[model samples]
Structures are given as C-alpha cells and as structure tokens.
Target: QSEIPMQKPFQQVKELVMEYPVSENEPTEENSYLSYNLVVGDSLDVEKCTAFEVLDYVLLSEPGAPLKQALLDAGLGKDILGSYEDGIYQPFFSIVAKNARPEDKDRFVDLIKETLEKIVKEGIDQKAVAAGINYMEFRFREADFSSFPKGLMYGIDVFDSWLYDEGRPFDHLKKLGIFDKLKKEAKTGYFENLIEEYFLNNTHGSVVVVNPKRGLAAQREKELEEKLAAYKASLSPKEQEKLVKDTVHLKEYQDSPESQEALNTIPLLKREDISRKAGRLYNTEKHCQDTLILHHDLDTNGIGYLELLFDTKQVPERLVPYMGILKSVLGYVDTENFTYGELSNEINSRSGGIYFGVQVFGNAWDNKKTVHMLGIKAKALYQDIPFVFRMIKEILGTSRLGDEKRLYEIIARMKSRQQMSMASAGHSTAVMRALSYFSETACFQEKVAGIDFYRLLDDLEKNFQERKEGLIAALKELIHYIFRPENLMVSYTSDEAGYHGLEGEIRELKAGLCTEEIQGEPAVSVFEVKNEGFQTSGQVQYVAAAGNFAEAGYHYTGALRILKVMLSYEYLWMNIRVKGGAYGCMSSFRRNGDSFLVSYRDPNLRKTLEVFQKTGDFIRSFQADEREMTKYIIGTISELDTPLTPSAKGSMSLNAWFSQVKEEDLQQEREQILDAGPQDIRNLAELVDAVMKQNRFCVIGSEEKLQQEKELFQEMKYLL
Candidate 1:
C-alpha cells in the first residue's frame, strides 16, 4: 500500500446528483396518458431479505433514477415494506411499484426493457403466472367480498377519487376494460389491486438509492428522515386551503332545506316490503316534509312483523331527540324480542329459517334510505350478539368508542400476530375492513339527523338504567310485531328416519359417488376425551401429506410431513384399514389446506392383531426426504399465525366452539412455537402417536376393504 497520507492523501467525497426534466416534452393526444408497472418475486429466506434485495437490485440496476428512489425511500422512520409471504399460489410479488414516465421517454423506456429482459433471462417461471391466475380465481370463488361494508367502499372510492385528481398511475388496478371484466367475474384478482394499492402503498411508491454495502443503510435512514420532515412541513399551505373549504361546506349544509327536513325525521327499521314503498314529499314550515316508508321482512320462527317507517321532512329542532330515541329502540339485534342466537337456532332447527337486520344509510347530515342489503350473523358461542348489538347501537347513536375494551383486545391480538409472521394477504384485508367498519360506522348519520342519533343513544342508555323492564318490554313488543307466526315460515321434517346418529350425519346417498358409515363397524374409537388436562382435547385423524419443494426439486420437508400424517392415520387404524378390520384407511394430500397427515374413517377395532401387524409395513414402505425441509418449516410458520377473515374468523370460531378450545389457548400454543425447528415437528408427531392409540375413530368406508380382514378383527378380540 502506498503511503498516500504522506503525499496528498485525501479522498474527496461528493454526492453524485443527477437531474432530469419533469417531462420529455413528448407530444400527446388530448385526454391521453402513459402508464408503466413493475412486479418483483419474493423468496422465503427470511435472512435473505429477498424483498430488500429486489428493491436494492432495482436501484443498483438503474442508477440515477430519481422517480424510483422516491418511492422506495418513503419508509423514512416506519417498518418499511412490511411482511411478505412466500410460495403461496397467489402472487407473492407486488405490483405496488409504479411510474408514469411517458411512453416516448427514451431513457425510462430503455430502463424497463433492460430490467424485464434481465428478469426473464434469470429464469422467470411461467408456472408462477399460471399459479397467480389460478390463485386469483380460487380466492374469488371462496371469498365473500360482499360482506364488506358499504361505508368502506364509500371511503375507498373517495380516496381513489382524490388520487385520480392527483394524476397517479393505477397500473396495479386492472385496465379499465380489464377492471370491468374482473368486476363482472368477481375475480379474486380484483381484490389484488386493492391489496397492493393499500397494503403495498403502490399508489405512492417508494424510491431508494441502493449501494451494495450494508453500512450505508443507517446513513440513508437518517438522510431520508430529514428530507421527509422538510417535505411534510411544506404542506401547510395546502392544508390551510382545505380547512377554509370545509368551513364553507359546513355553512352551506346548515342552510339547506333537505338537511333541515332530514334532521326532523326519525328513522325506523322497517320490516315489510321496502322496495314497493315510495317516498312522498311535502311542503312544511321547518323546511320540507316527506314520508319515505321502507319495509323488509326477515322471518324467524314463523313470525313476521310490519315495520312502518315515517320520515318527517319538517318539525321542530327538538324532534331530533325523538329520532334518536327511535334508533336506540330499533337498532339492537334481537333486542326486539329474541337475541340473534335464539332466532338463528329457531330458524335452522325448523328447516330453512331467516333472520332480519336493519340499517340506515346516507351522508353525515341528511341522507336517504340505504338499508336493503345488510346481513348480520351472530354466533352464540363466540360472540355476544345482544352485547355486540348494544355496542353497535351505542357507537352509532352516541359515542365513537363503543366496546372499547373489546376493540383493544382484538387489535392487540392482531398486532401481535402481524409481528409474528407474514399473515395471509386475503385474510388481512378482510379483517382490517371488518374492524375499521365496527370502529367507525356512521351509516345512520346521513339518513336521520345527527342530533337524533345522539339523542336516541342517550335515551336508550338512560332508560336502560331506569325503566329496564319497560325498555325490555318495548324491545320484545317490536320483536313480536316483526316475528309473528304469520310473517315467517320454514319446512320441517317430523320423520325420525331423517334424524341419524352422528356417524351417519354426513351422507352422500344421492350423489354419483357415494360413501356410507355403517353401524357396528369396527372403528379405531378416536373420540374426544373431555376432562383431560390439555386445554384442547379433540381427537383428529391425520390423513394426508403435502410438502413445500425447496432447492429446485428437493422435498425433504414434504416427505417428513407425509410420513407424519400417514403414520398417524395408519397406526390408529392398523387392523381397521390395512388388515381389513375396516375399509380404506389411507392418507392424502391437500395443497390448499396447509397440512400433511394420515387419516382413517373406518377402522376394524376387532382386528387389533392384523392392525398391529400392518403398522410395520406402513412404516417401512415410505421414502425418505428428497428435498430441503427448511423451506416447509418456514412456510408453515408464516401461515399458522395469519389474521382472520369472516371465513377464517367463522371457521376458527366454529372450531373453538366445537372443539372446546379457547382463543387464548390457541395463542398460547402459537407462542410456544418460538422458532420452528425439526424438534418441534418431532414432538408434534410424538403427540399424534399418543392421540391415535387412545381415541375412537369413525369408519366411513366400503365393505370390500373390511370383509377380508375379518380374521384380524377376530384375533384382536380373542387377545382382548
């Protein structure tokens, strides 16, 4: 090394800054625009930071790209480019990154071309594209997006309108024609746009300058924070302008007759034919007078009631109090007579039963009847419907924070889950929408006077403390009026033949391919053992194995999963499945269910000798792990703690209710998995061993799989 310090050893440092004109002066036809999009795949190596690397690769690959850097650098002091999932059928990559460089901009165009070429040459998997499309279709088919609240749609639409006005490229969104197609098909991919737009912050992408070294990240963070602070400080002028406009809006609304008339009217939940009803307008002193009667019948227990809604277009300002009272009285779910639980049970039990829910819609001041499509299903075991209803009514009619304790509990659980692993994208979106609605629903504010809403809440809360019986009587009376025997109906089956035992509950007698569970069949006797020490004690047969492929085609983890599920199933029904104690004992694979296990429906318990003999063959007949297992471990960890959607939420709730598992217990079990290691799985497999031996298994099989194994059953019975 030369002694540069001795001579004139000083390395001059300077920021290499580049500038480009905002527009390339590209000529364009009127009403025409240019758009470009970028998608990057993610790898599951948590230590690898594929997401970070991809962004860095983008920046390093295209030096002197200010537009790109701006989007990536936006996470100044935040968690930056949050959690990402790996190896899901859905697109694991993001289309959040976008730019509006003109089509004719040579440099920008050349840059995209270069990058796309490199990506393909590096081996872009066509399978990924097909997987993405299939995932989208499956998601659309399974998802219940209609459950999303209208308020959310309204808010998102307003937000989008603002973005449109600001001239942002919505490349993540399908093209106008494509968007319509997706909307019509109800493609799950349609949601991908919103997921990317909101979750990925695709609308306003980040730009980061990538230097191949790690040390620069700290310096970059500091510099980025200062820059963003300065930019935010500069927005004061625009904010002030917005404030003035809002004030003007308030004044204009105050003087509007429609607003005044809406304020006077008290809204009610109509329980008859709302569609055929019409709105009648009248001239009055307070402002205007109108009667818009609405009725929608939801029958429960052969009862129906008529809901007469009279919206007064004119009245004294004090009339708002009366409106408030009406809302408080009418809003509680099942508060009218029976709780929602009672209604659901009565209806489902009777045959095909229905339940009614009501809502008011419109703007913040005066709005119109917008309640026709709101459906509420309250679970008795998992949710307190009456309490939830009270909370909802209280929030809508009175305070902003109804059920504050419950909300905090829910948010805390969600936040913890997010910190643990990458949550399922679909589930996360669903949860946020649901919770946000419950947290900030003001659907009734516009249709009725805001004052009325507040007054009704106060009246309900006050009356509950004073004349509780009278209030209950009023609610029951309302319920009686709506759920009268004449108003509702359901089909009933009185024949005992239709009521089968638990084993015969799931039958496919009418189907082309049918399976049946015969009586007195030899089963593994895998029944739940209650009063057990464990919090969760239900016995389940593991029936399949599917593994994540790692390192090209290696399936080590997949093999382990297959072995575990298979062994458990076979061990339980040794004589029952293989030795002909029962028919068709085998394990299968389900790609979507995220599990690999063995299962047996029918087990020949009587043939314990042959069953024991078959276990050795089952164990010896399997292949060893053929691929890297670490990837499967990582993927499993990522999904186990994912957030809940209505579907997931409902499923989890039902599981807990039926299995007698508490939410807290599940959380504890998850937390126990501090880090997914081989030992964790080994222990889980061992547990399966204990469970298979003790529980009774159900048999759903063919007589053929069992007839020949009668000797095994006889031997086991003789030994016993």
Candidate 2:
C-alpha cells in the first residue's frame, strides 16, 4: 500500500498545458471558459489519508468558502470535479461563465488564482468548516446502504482493498476512526498548510482555456476523412482481408451462446434468495383542508421530506412550456426578502435542498385520464421544518419572475446544460420524443420539457429582448392559474414523531396559499406521431422506436416485463451494443403500456432501427431453457427488490397514490412475474410484431449521418 510521509509535504511539480477553440456547435456569442485541474500525483493510503479526503470534502462542500464566494461574485459557479483511487486523487475546479467575453477570461483566471492564495493564507471560515463537518458526519452516518446491493458493494470494497494491498476492507469501526481523526485535524491549521503545499505554491497544475471558434466541426470532419482515406490507401490487400476476417470473427463471437458452465460460473441470485412477500410498505394517511395531505410514516433519522403537488389540469395548454421555465427559475430567482445568492446560502445552511418540477403520470383508474402535477419538493431536518415551510411559501408567493437579467441568465444556463446533455443523453431525449406521439400525457411532456422544450428555450434565449414581455406575462398567467390552494396536494415522509410535530405547521402553511379556485380542467390536445430526425454535433446517434400498446387495447402484463428483460439482455445487447458497436441498448416497458426500444451512443441510426424492427422475429425464434428462464426471473425480482432511500420511497409512494395503484396491485404483479414461464414469453412475441409494424421512431445524431438518410424521416431538425 502507498504510505504518506508525515513530513516534507512539498513533492515534485509537473505541468501540462493545452488550449483549444470551442466547437462550431456550441453557442459562442460571447462566452469563453477556463478550467484548472490540480491533481495530487500520489496514491492515497486510505487508512492514513482519510483526513485528506475529509478535508477535500470540507473545502468542496462549504458554499460560503472564500473561493466559492469570489467565483459567484464574478457571475460564475464553481463546479468541483474529482475522482479518487486507492493511492491516487484527482480533484479539479471547473468555473463556467455563460456570458463571459474574451476580455473577461484572464480576469477570471486571475481571480481564481487570488482566491487560492487567500485560502492558503487565511484558511476557511470556522462556521463554514463546522457546517462542512456536520454535513459530512450526517452523510457518513445517515447514508442509505440499502439503496444498492449490499453484497455487491462489499465485494467491490474488498476487491479494492486487496488491489491496494490494504490490510482489510473498511468497516464501521474503521470509518468511525477516520471520522474522529478528521474532526481532530479540522480544528488545527492542518488544512491551510496542506492547501499551501499542494495548491498555492505548487507548480504542478494545468490551465485549460476553451474559446469559441466557428466551423470547428466541419474542419475536424474533413481532417478525419482525409486521415481515413490515407490509412485505407496505405493498407495492403492481405492486411485488409485479415481486418475483414477479424471483424467477422468478432461478430460471430458476440452472436455465439455462452457455454452452460460459463453461465453457471457467473454470480447470480438464486430463486430461493428471492422473497415472495412484498417488502416494507408505507403507512399512508390523508388529511383534508383546502388541499389534500398525503402523509407517510417512515424512519428518516431526523430528516424530513415534504412535497407539494399542484394539480396543473386547470392550466391552459399554451402555458405548458412556461411551466418548464418556472420549474427552472422559481427557487433560483430572488424572493421578496432575499437575493438569489442569499436564498441559496440560506437553503444550503438550513436545509438539504428545495426544487420544483412538473410530473405527469397516467391515471390508474381511467385509461383516458392523466395526472399533471407541478411538484415542489424540499428536504430539511426535523427541527427546521418551519424553515422548510417558509422557504416553500417564499418560492411560490414572492419569487421574482420579471427580473429580466436574472431570467436571461437562467435561460442561458438551462440552454447550456441541455446542449451538454444532448451529447451524453441524446438517447433519452430521442425516446421521449418518439413516445410523445402515442399519448396526451407523453405529448404534453415533450412540449413541456423534452427535445421540443429545448428548441423553445433556444428560441427564447436568442430572441429574449423581443419576447421578454410576452414571456413574463405568460409566466405570471401560469402562476395565477396553477398556484392555488384548491389545486394543492401535500405529501411528506418522516419518522412518526417528526410527522406529528410538523403536521400543524404544514396545515398552517397550506391554509395561507391563494384560495382562488380553478374553474375548469385544461383542454387536452391530440398529436400525430412525428417520425423525425434531430441533427447534432454528437459523434454517435441515439435511436428510439416506440409504440403505445395501451392505445391498441393491449394492457401491461407480467409477460411483457419478462419479455423486456430477455430482449434487453440478449437481443438488444447482442445486436445493437455488442455487434453494432453502440455503448448500450435497452428495451423498456412502462406500466402505462408505452414501450421503447432504444440504442445509446450508437454508430448507426438506420441499422439500429432495422435491428429494433427485427425484434419480433428475434422474440419468435428465441429459445431459452429452464435455467435461462430462472436467471431472468431472478434478475427481474432483484430489480423489484432494490431498496429506496426514505425520500425516494416517499416520492414513489406518493406517485403510486396519484396513479391510484394499490399495494395489492403490486403484489399481484409480483406474483404474475414469478409465475411467468415459456408460454408467457411466447405470448409477447405477437405484441412485439404488432409494435414493430406501427413504425414510430426518432433519431438524434450527427448532422452528417442524419442528412445522409433524411429520406427515412418525415421531418428533419437541427438542434443548434
């Protein structure tokens, strides 16, 4: 194991420098960004260097830290990024300023440097340090270990310890010791000294400044094609034949079935290990006032989770897009009494977090009905329940919507984040767009916050000056219609005592909301399936083809769930990911009977769609033995059995309630899944055949690839 020396903290320093212009696809009106990555080029000794990790966490978590304050003052947010290994730690600070001019780049860099220097000289605030320590302690002690597979986590920790040559895997006692050591070290000037040695005076660092440049994508594409052509020309005939042979061999290997012995060798949960009974179920109680309150009693240490779901059925369809805007900016903008920064600090210091979003779910009782909720979720300690209530009230009642500068900043930030997401999660967006065609809820979801939402945001950002008044007025109108006590449904999760104590406070808060009643339900609109292609700068494509079985009178069954597992593991994995060179692929079946076959980070769009279209044939021909069926059954049960954190569990329970799904329904579903067999699997093949014939699909990919097959799509759009 790597050891840490008690003395001589200054080590060798190395520097790596690189400069790159931004891509042609990125918005480059005036924004340029700089990143600094300070890496400790040494292996960490977990036993001895736990204090160091804690110190790093403290520095990162303290929102009131000098460096963070400085960055915020410069209209930038400090995005700290890091990874740790047995003996290596790499932590860096990424400061992004969306509206930065070229002239501001050097000033931002100098400010960052000066902030570090100040940290080295004066150390962090004592109150901030205390808060960090408290937060870390709570995280360590109150973490939900059941959220993931305990056995898998244990095996990973053991393997890591063995790889590092540590004596043993970490346990509760060892962890407590580390925490104790961290507390002691935090009281001294230890962190300041470490910062000075490792960062302030250290010469080992790199500064990466990325500036926006037009046409970089086209230039790079040309260079790549030239390189490929030259490589092809240089290849000998024999070498080319051998390369073809190697590719054929790889395809064959991926297609070949694994030996029984090999399959048995893999770690898997046995059927006996699966529980037949439902796990812990929440005890739900409802209270009525102007709004309905749904309460779930679950042990949450001393923490409380509160959620307000406002019925948005009364909101006009035209205001749906603004709901997304409101969700993004509501808690982020200034309130009547506090600036945005002050609100942020207050929330961080007093509570865990407060946020808002719109949630759409298909109604459980009625097939044609869908529940549209504007949800406000917050978390806080039991003692700070009043503060949570106050914060929620302030956000809903006094949040400034007409602050044009702040509004524009929020739009720019949201646009930037969405653009970044396209490169990584385009598959999700594609699937959402494809599914939007089948149902009113799905269509509304797409318009509100899917790929269509991104386009709306882009237009708003580019033409903000022209559309400012209309946008603000629309937002105000949305607030007027949706933010009413009559439309509210309150839900909370906490220990029994905490719930009882905060019940009256919550009731008082609900009573104070706007008492005006909504007159009528929002008009629902129908949309046709749009077989579209979205062109982006992403190197790979995200392909999705979906069909709503419910619309065709096909209800969700356990057979469909089992079929999903089989197709995802065998058919999709082998065809699209393993053989087609995609990063991943999945087949999802929703309870609402919306199913999607999606390929992620895929190299081929048309070919991936072809593979999806052929799924029916694959399902019809699939032959699985008893062992294979048992394995899939166990896998499905394992997924169903995965535990959730208190907050997550509460939210899930509330959603189930909204959907009118009872515990009995879930138990029956579990039984159905357990009883699923070969016949059940065979029955789903016909459904797959039907779905493929419907031919609803969407593809998001590079402009080059998308344009190459534009004829395959009904409409083509550019993301940028």
Q: Estimate each model's TM-score.
A: 0.21, 0.86
Report residue 96 deviation for candidate 2 (angstroms). 4.5
Model 2 misplaced stretches (Cα beyond 4 Å) = 3-32, 40-87, 96-104, 115-132, 145-147, 150-165, 168-199, 212-236, 261-273, 279-283, 288-290, 364-368, 470-472, 516-523
Against the reference, the lDDT scores of all candidates come to 0.29, 0.71
lDDT of 1: 0.29
Judge candidate 2 at residue 60 and give its lDDT: 41
Clashes of 1: 62
Best by lDDT: 2
> Mind giving the per-residue lDDT tens digits that candidate 1 earns over 1-720?
111222221132111222211111211221111222222222222222222222232322121122232332331111112223332211233222222222223343344345444443353322222222333333323333444644454454333323323343232222334323433432333233333332233322222222122223334446888998787677788886887798788666543435435643744322221222221111111111122211111112222211222222222233322333333233223423444223222322222222233333221111111221122222211112223333333322332223322222222222223322211121122122211221112223311323223234334433434534443443333332322222221111111221122111111101111123212211111112121110000111112112212212222232344343444443543434543433334432221111222233333323432353344344444332312233343333334534333333433433233233444544443333323344444533432333233322221112222234433221111000
Off by over 4 Å in 1: 1-629, 638-644, 650-664, 684-686, 692-699, 714-720
Model 1: ten consecutive residues of lowest lDDT: 531-540
